[model samples]
Target chain A: MNRFKNNLTPYFFIMPAVILLSIFSFLPIIVSLGISFTDMNLRGLANWSTINFIGFDNFVQLFQDKVFLKSMGNTFIYVIIGVPMAVISSFVIAYLLKLVSDWMSTTFRVIYYIPSVTNIVAIAVVWSFLYNQEYGLFNYLLSLVNLDAIPWLEDPFIAKLSLIAMAVWKSNGVSMLIFLAALQSIPKMYYEAADIDGANRWQKLFKITLPSMSFATFFVVVTTLIGWLQFFEEPFVMTNGGPLNGTNSLALFIYQEGFQYSEFGYGAAASFVLFIIIILATLLQFKLRKSEDK
Target chain B: MDLKNNFERAIVNTVLFIGGLLVSLPFVWMILSSLKNEREVLSIPPTLFPNAPTFEHYINLFTNLNFDVYLVNTLIIVFFSMVGLLLNTMAGYGFGKFQFKGKEIWFAVVLLTMMIPGQVTMIPTYLILNEAGLTNSMTGIILPGLIAAFNIFLIRQFMVTIPDDLIEAARLDGAGELYIFFKLIIPLAKPILAVQVILTFIGSWNSFLWPLIIANEERLYTLSVGLALLQDQNVSNYGLQMAGSTFMVVPVLIIFIIFQKHIVEGFNVSGIK
Candidate 1:
């Protein structure tokens, strides 16, 4: 009897979370998968709306949509630029801080991490000001050196760049902290040995620091890629994917289709496509990491 | 070598000092502009000082925006979700430590859902809520969020560290599951709970996308959603927007200042960074 009760206990404990997940997470996906098969739009209901089974039509239409294509391109561009910039900058900052006094390193780490913890909306507000067209801090700084006021948000090209730059600022702190942990884990003896070999600072960094953090680097790269793929909030908050949908990410597109336009069926289809892309990207990352390790 | 290294250190220090200032420039500007009057704020070559800083905007948010409604709404949703999280933690402990049929399979299924991006299922979620007529209700706002698989995983990982013998001893004492969960398990799991609370609070606080979708009524809007609405209405009103932004930023800052150690410790536990 005791053994039976023990066997049942785990299920009993997990029951609440499992039930909630089944309702919110699992049920929604199943419903979405079902909804993807039909032309369920704002004019329709689930059971009542003569929902025709339009196999691959939605996905096909998704490819033909220029806005969807733009979203895909912008999302990739954001991910490609934002992830690497954030990872590289954070790692470099973390690596350099290691050379500073211990107290200073700790202080800088926390300070650098402040932006990471703050909300994205708040970050967007501050950065939008800095990226302001007139009397903006960034343009003012550029002006001091006789540079033209770059239309940071006004131009599509510069708008994407502005969003990406803000993304790096907002994201770098967390990656930096992760890199700091990876840095701390490296044995001092490896560096001491490099010193004996007359390895200079650059050599030591390239040889010892970078190589030792391979796992963490891989981890950061994967997660960062995943994050940047879903680049919604920054652009959504900062630019509203303006000044001509230049910064409109697929995530934002998904948001716009569903919320702004109320194209639920089409939005679900786009989102599923995005999910597939993310899955493929994650798989590729893992494959690459495995090959490098080998 | 030492002197030359010191000289290099001096150069690095100068660069980093500037870098730090550049990094924190927005925050500094945020604080400054929030205090400034309209002219001082938008002035060409903006003044560093606000001259006559006022709490008018903060006062304005409280009066006009009904920022307190959003605050209360946020608190209510976050509080219930925290209760749900407590239940989640208990379940996680049970799963991690207790023996059950299909335990690994169930755990795998739970973990699998985490990988499925929340964005993908968002439309269906809105549909579900709409069908159920829970839209514009606090229950709708907090109910879906309460289904946190990540928290379950986090708490499960934490529960594994608790010695099994203590639980066995409690079982021997004829204590029921609820008693063990409340008296023994919860007391032992405070550190992990602390981490979960801070993370969930921040997550719930900064939650924008979901709340914006479900909570159609302004009265039900959380601060993040409210801030977004404020920005949409007053796109060019940088001063008022900044004020609203400052209002949102300040509470989180206050929470961080008071519980920074716990916040960092929570991040460590959650493996967020």
Candidate 2:
């Protein structure tokens, strides 16, 4: 009886989490998946029979859709550029911070990290103002420097790059903190050994510092890539996929299709496409980890 | 050799100081712009300091824009959601402490849900809330987000570190399961709770997408949605826009300033530890 009671206790404890998870997370995905196979539009919800089955039609349409294609392309550019910039910048910052005194280090770290901790929406608003075409601080400063006010958010190509810059500014600090911790974890013995070998700072950095942080490098890259793929907040709050829709990302595109256009079926299909891509990327990361372990 | 090392350290410090200033310039610009006259705010060379700092925009937010109403709404949602989070945490502790059949399967199911993007069920969720007549209500905002898979996973992982002997002692003292959780587990779990609460509060406070979608009434808008609208409301007024943006970030900024150490520790503790 005691043993049985022990067995029941764990289930009782986890039951609430199980219930909430089912309702909020699991139930939604299952519904989205089910709806993806059918031509379920907003108007058809009132009429049960109107929701007809359309297998892979939405997916095929998404591929052919021009805006969807552009959003996908923008998302790739964001990941490729934004992730590396954030990672390398943070690593260098963290490394430099490590050499400073404790108080100075902590103060600088806090300053760098304020953007990460502050509300993204607020940051987006401030950044949008900074990026405004006229009477904006960016352009105002440009005039002082004898340069023309390049359309930060008004031109398609410039808008995409602007979004990438905002993404890096908002996110680099968290990566900085991660890299700082990894830096601290590196054994002092290695540095001492490098010193004994008469290795200079640059040589030690390339041979010891970079190689020692391999795990952290991998973790940061994978997480940053995952985050960039789901880039929504900045574009939604700042650009709204405007200026020829150059700044629209996959996640923003999903929102646009579903909420703005009421293309629920097509939106669900696109969402799942993103879901599959994320899963495949995650799996590839895991495969790399497995091989490294071997 | 010592002189050379000191020289190198000085260079590193100088580089870091410059980098830190560049990183923080946007925030400094926002705060200064908020206090500046409108013309100065839009001027070329972007004055680094206000000629005459004023609180006109902050005053306007409360008097004309009903900023208080949104603040109250944000407070209401955050408070109630925290209450619900307490319940969820207790449930998480129970799951981690006790053993039962189907445990692995249920936990796996929870993990699986975390992988799915929130966009998938957003429409259905809106539909469900609308059908339940909860749209435009604070319940619409708080209820859906009260419990999270990530929070449960976080709390449970922390709980697993608690030794079993403590629970046995509480049981021997005739303490009820709920009593032990409330009395013992909670006190010990303060560190994790601090991290979770800060993370949860920041997340809810900054949540724009879901709130923008569900909240129809301007009065019910959180700071995030309110700041977004401030852009349109004060379209040409960069001063007011900066003021509103600065306002939106103040609470989070204060919290982060106070808890900087824990905030960094929170990230490291959650993952790398």
Candidate 3:
């Protein structure tokens, strides 16, 4: 009896999390996958008998969905532009931060980090004011420079960029902190040795800094890529994928379809597509890193 | 060499200062605009400082907008965070210390779940909640986010570093497992617990999408959702929006200021590990 009780002890400790995850996380993934193959709409949700297993029809329709395709393209544009901007800019800021005094660095770190901690809705609200075409800060500044007032979130193309800009600002702090941590972890001896060899700052940066921080860079890139792929909140709050589905993201598309339109099966299909893309992107990054190692 | 170094330092400081101002400009503007009257906010040649700052919008938020209710609703996130922390810590301690059957496999499953984005599971989760009559309720919003896989992984990583000898010694004294966990493990895991607390607090506080979806009723809406709705309803009322934004942001900013050290250190630990 004692041995049996001891054997079950670990299970007792872990059971709560296991149960929660199984219901909320694991089961949902499987169910969502199953739902993707069925014509599960609001009626189907209401009456189980109304649902039909439609096979690949939902996936087939998703491919030809213009809005879905537009969202996919917008997500790609976001990742393509936003990822590099986030990674590179944060890296540069982190490097620059390392040059400053300890107090200054800490102060600036907290300042930059303020946006990340604040609620996205609040950030969106503020940015909307800033992006307001009339009596807005951005346009007002442009006018001061004798340039024409450009629509920040009004034009479809510019709306996408505007969302990306806010996202980059909101996110840059976290990656910047990560990079700073990475930079701090590098051995001081490497730099000393480089200085002994009469290496310039650029030479040392290329030879010592970049190579040493490769893993950190990879981690940042992969995480940022995954995050940008699921870009939702900015567009949801700011544009609602506005000005002709310009800022629409795959995640937002899933939300609008599943919750708003009750197109459960279609949304699930789009979600799986995104899931596959994220897995592939992550795997490709890992593969590239491995090849680089060789 | 000293002069050159000082010159470089001056330039770096200047650039960072400018960057800092630019980064914080929105926040400053949010607060400033919240204090401005409706007309003043939309005035041409936007004023940096309100000529006669008023608390009318802030007052409006509390009185007309049900912000007091929203604030109470937002505080319920604390309950979710606390419950999640307790559950994740228990699981973490189990995974870290125990040599149970299929432990490795179960731990692997937890890590694998981390890779699956929340959106993929969102639809089915909502359906399940709706079926259970949990939708349009605070319970619905709380249930889905109760156990983050990453938190379990983080706690487990921290717990594994705890010495096994201590546990063995406590067991030799005939201390029960639950007692040992409550008495010994909880106190010792303070640092990781602190990290988890701040992370979950900020995460739950700022969470928008799930709450927005689950809470359709105004009374149940979290601050994030309420503020979003307010923004939509009052599209051109920049003052009201800013006031609402300020109310939503101030608690987080205060928490960040107080816990800045732990917040930064926590991110460093999570990012590097």
Superposed on all Cα atoms, the candidates' RMSDs to the truth, in angstroms, are 2.3, 2.3, 1.6
lDDT by residue (A1-294, candidate 2, tens digit) is 776666676666666667766776777777788778878877766676899899999998999999999999998888888988989888988888888888988899988888887888778888887888886777877888889988999888889899889889888777888888888888889988888999888888988888777788888878887888899988888888887888999999988888888777888889988888877877888788779768
lDDT against true structure, model 2: 0.81
- Please give, for residues B22-51, the per-residue lDDT of candidate 2 as tens digits: 778788889999998888887765678898
Q: How big is the positional error of residue B97 in model 3, measured in Å on the Cα after superposition?
A: 0.8
lDDT of 1: 0.82
lDDT of 3 by residue, A159-219 (tens): 9999989998999878888899889988989988887898888888999899988988999
Chain B TM-score, model 2, reads 0.92
Q: lDDT per residue, candidate 1, B1-273, as tens digits?
A: 111477889876776677788788888888888887767778887788788988777787889887899888878877887888877896788777877677888788788889989788899988898899888887888888886888888788888988999988998999988899989999898977886787777777777777888888988999888888887887666777788887777777677657766654345613422
* Candidate 3 docking class: medium
**DockQ comparisons of all candidates to the true complex:** 0.55, 0.59, 0.69
Q: How high is the lDDT of residue B54 in model 3?
A: 100
Native contacts, share recovered per candidate: 0.54, 0.67, 0.75
Worst 10 residues of 2 chain A by lDDT: A3-12
Q: Evaluated with TM-score, which candidate comes out highest?
A: 3
Residue pairs whose backbone atoms clash in candidate 1: none
